[model samples]
Target: MHRRRELVGWATVGVVLCALAIPWFLWGSSTVVFGLPLWLWWHVGWMVLASAVFWLFARRAWGLGVETADSSERASATASVGDGGGSR
Candidate 1:
């Protein structure tokens, strides 16, 4: 779970960096792809790529079923440890 969360974080950073940086790099391009300017196509491509990355992150890291199980285990462990009821 921790590794999956880390992967999701890295993927999110990648998507954000690509969205912000790629267009700036292509700011003066006059090339065309599929009838759009190259810079415009670059933005569109990143949008699609970001969507896929987010979907993968969601599927792997956001599943409620696993979280519930982990939470329940933690709750049981905490209950077994109990508060010390200090300083009587």
Candidate 2:
């Protein structure tokens, strides 16, 4: 039941994102704010960005382990990071 609810919510979000991007991609120039041209790319970018963030959040909550990087890769990144030691 919980999974279904999360899926439905995500699906609704994805649909809304697509709706925004598709129409903007098709006819975006007319929609403007303060004389700035509202291009389709802008909408597409936002939709994509939002989806990525939401996916990460949901994956974490669902324990899906769907991060942008592999575990080993993340480990390597951490290994290469600055020291945890604080100033004396």
Candidate 3:
């Protein structure tokens, strides 16, 4: 259930990012931010946002389990190796 919620949260973030990337939202704007046109700023902002979202999703969804699984597998393999070449 927790994982499902996390996936849904990520999906919501993806949808928002897609919506923000649509040019219509930034069209007809003459403002400038940080020495860049508004439209360009919008895109740059979204790019940064997308990177952050991806990092969060990767860390939460895959990072922890992969490390734990790898460590346990290594431990089991070492134990088997120590058991003397098994079933010769």
Candidate 4:
């Protein structure tokens, strides 16, 4: 399940990256916003989208391939530390 979710998340990131790379849709557009061309605006919006996707990835799946101790293990370790690591 973890592997599947990771694959899907990364796939979404790849799609967003590809969209940012190509601005074919705006090639014929002459629209202007604020002072910039449509394509420039497209880039800005795409960059914001990419940042959001990356933020989600960082929040949810940033620990790819890294080993982490289980919660139970952590609890036991904390208990051991609280006992000074010596027999009473």
Candidate 2 deviant stretches above 4 angstroms: 22-36, 40-48, 54-58, 61-88
Q: Which lDDT tens digits does candidate 3 get at residues 6-87? A: 5577678779888878558657888887798888877887798889878887765654334454454465576664443232
Q: What is the TM-score of each predicted model, taking all chains together?
A: 0.52, 0.40, 0.56, 0.57
lDDT of 2: 0.56
- Residues 1-88 of candidate 1 have per-residue lDDT tens digits of 5434565677677667666746887767899887888888777777887788778767756543345545644554677653332211
Best by lDDT: 4
Score candidate 1 by TM-score against the native.
0.52
Q: Candidate 2: lDDT of 1? A: 37
The candidate scoring highest on TM-score is 4
Candidate 3: clashing pairs of residues: none
Q: Each model's number of backbone clashes?
A: 0, 0, 0, 0
Model 4 root-mean-square deviation:
9.2
TM-score of 4: 0.57
Evaluation by TM-score, superior candidate among 1 and 4: 4
The TM-score obtained by model 2 is: 0.40
Q: Which scores higher on TM-score, 2 or 4?
A: 4
Candidate 4: lDDT of 53? 76
Q: What's the C-alpha lDDT at position 10 in model 2?
A: 65
